[model samples]
Target: MTSQPTPFVIGIDGPSGSGKSSVSRAVATQLGAGYLDTGAMYRALTWWCCHTEIDLGNAAAITRAAVELPLDIGDDPSAPTVVVDGTDVAEAIRTSEVSSLVSTVATVPEVRVEMQRRQRELIEQIAARHGSCVAEGRDVTTVIAPDAQVRILLTASEEARLRRRSLEVHGATDEAAIDATRDQVVRRDRDDSTVSQFTEAADGVSVVDTSDLDFEGSVAAVMALVDAARRR
Candidate 1:
């Protein structure tokens, strides 16, 4: 029998509004691989805690919830889903409330440890099923999948990030919209950075700046990196 090619595990890390989700999905689709939104795992856990009335400030309680989260996130990049306890929260986890408080759940060291363990398991499962998988999140490149064949840090300017987040949350980039999104996108980044080093690319990781790139351009930039990595 012919030897099967080694599976590809692409790890992407970036801050909010850095085009990580879209770019990663596009790359996964183009490469015929599975896609994992690791950040959504954290957000889903946060939403579950909030929905169950778990206090966000209690580390032990939050860590316990993370350990027991009923998460069912899909790996299909074209039609990914997030189901918790039979409730689909794909859209719910993107709400302003979840975005604002997800950092609180994500910052708990125990919660991070539990989620990282879960993420590695998910990556292994996806790669086994699909021959390859592209996983993206704040710590995907550095922590969750540091040994991935292709590791990238997607970044953009804060001003650009705020504008993109404003458009996403409020459907407008006006001053009022940007102000409304500041707390979720900007403040959350501050809180999340305390636990993950996503601001810069680690040694041996590639960097892709999407500040001036449109959607297609950003996707292409990441795709180029993946192609180069595959050639090595």
Candidate 2:
């Protein structure tokens, strides 16, 4: 007789415009699991940094003050809400300006420590209720959810990723801006390279290149991996 499959955590990591967000959500929907965006937490802090005029270069100051930063993450999978200090910052956290600077604020060791703690706790709680999680971010698979039963690293060619980002935000309606935004993602990749330590090999990890698949297709790929893991 087949034993009951164990509930597990799924990690999806990739560079910007690699469809991590869209595909992760789709996979969560398919699996009926919770979705946590580790990047947005950093983005929220970045938003706070700019709004409060805090210098990003100082790690000590940021650490001491990081605890005071109000971060609210709602449980709704369809619409996860993020608020900082009572202000609804869900939309603000996704802006191009915030996106561009999030990595700067996130690279701080203190900030990563705090954020990583919160992310891990949140994942445990969500998995307890939902039975599993399909968490995605720059470091989810490698660092944040390294113990997750299933881990996947998703990526795509730079050019393809750029096109996807353009289409996601505005499609053909804003080709020039899409190209510009792609350049920003690339710059962010370069800036984040040194700070990122999320791709170190784990005992078992499935890496996929999403350069060819659309959003649904990528999600399907992740789900297939989950099925294989559950059967293991």
Candidate 3:
């Protein structure tokens, strides 16, 4: 009888527009591991709240929604899906409206606790199924999986980050496009910072600055860290 591979977990944290999602996905694919985009959980909850007519400002209501959020997220890096209450919201949750309000839902203490609980469960489930898993979010490294075998804080300079985000959102990196993208990347990070410390690396966390790296380079940098961790 063949034995299953031992499971491991990789946790990643980064600010908005820092390539956390893309890099983590790529790394997970290369390692043949499951991928969990924890940010998508918050965004899914925000979408659910709006869909149910729950006011974003009502903390108690939002907390209740979090507890009751019927979210089903896929762990496959190449083809991840986010479905809520039988509706595939993979794209809906990425809309500008959800982007603008996700922090509001994510900042509630009760919501974080609930989301963290779910995230931890998902990480363990994915790792157990796939032999390894990569989880990325604003607080994955610090709160969700601080003891992950490979913990990374992927970051880039503000200028680089804004340019990258502009290209992703507007398909252009001109000054005007970057300026237009600033609010989504900068303001969102600022709001989320009030609840999570992603801009800086926590103790024992490795940092990978992608200020000048392309997508492949960013993935390589993160993969290198995972390899080094595995070696230890």
- Give per-model TM-scores: 0.98, 0.90, 0.97
Better of 1 and 2 by lDDT: 1
Per-residue C-alpha lDDT of model 3 across residues 52-80, encoded as one tens digit per residue: 99988899999999999989999999999
Q: Which pairs in model 2 have colliding backbones?
A: none
Q: For model 1, what is the C-alpha lDDT against the true structure?
A: 0.93
**What is candidate 1's lDDT per residue for 81-169, written digit by digit as tens?**
99999999999999888988899899999999999999999999999889999999989998999999999999999999999989888
Error of 3 at 67 (Å): 0.4
* Model 1 residue 60 distance off true place after TM-score fit, in angstroms: 0.5
Model 3 alpha-carbon drift over 4 Å, by segment: 1-5
User: What C-alpha lDDT, on a 0 to 100 scale, does residue 87 get in candidate 2?
Assistant: 90
Residue runs of model 2 more than 4 Å from their true location after superposition: 1-7, 173-175, 198-203
What is the total number of backbone clashes in candidate 2?
A: 0
Q: So what's the TM-score on candidate 1?
A: 0.98
Instruction: Give the candidates in order of TM-score, highest first.
Output: 1, 3, 2
lDDT of each: 0.93, 0.79, 0.93
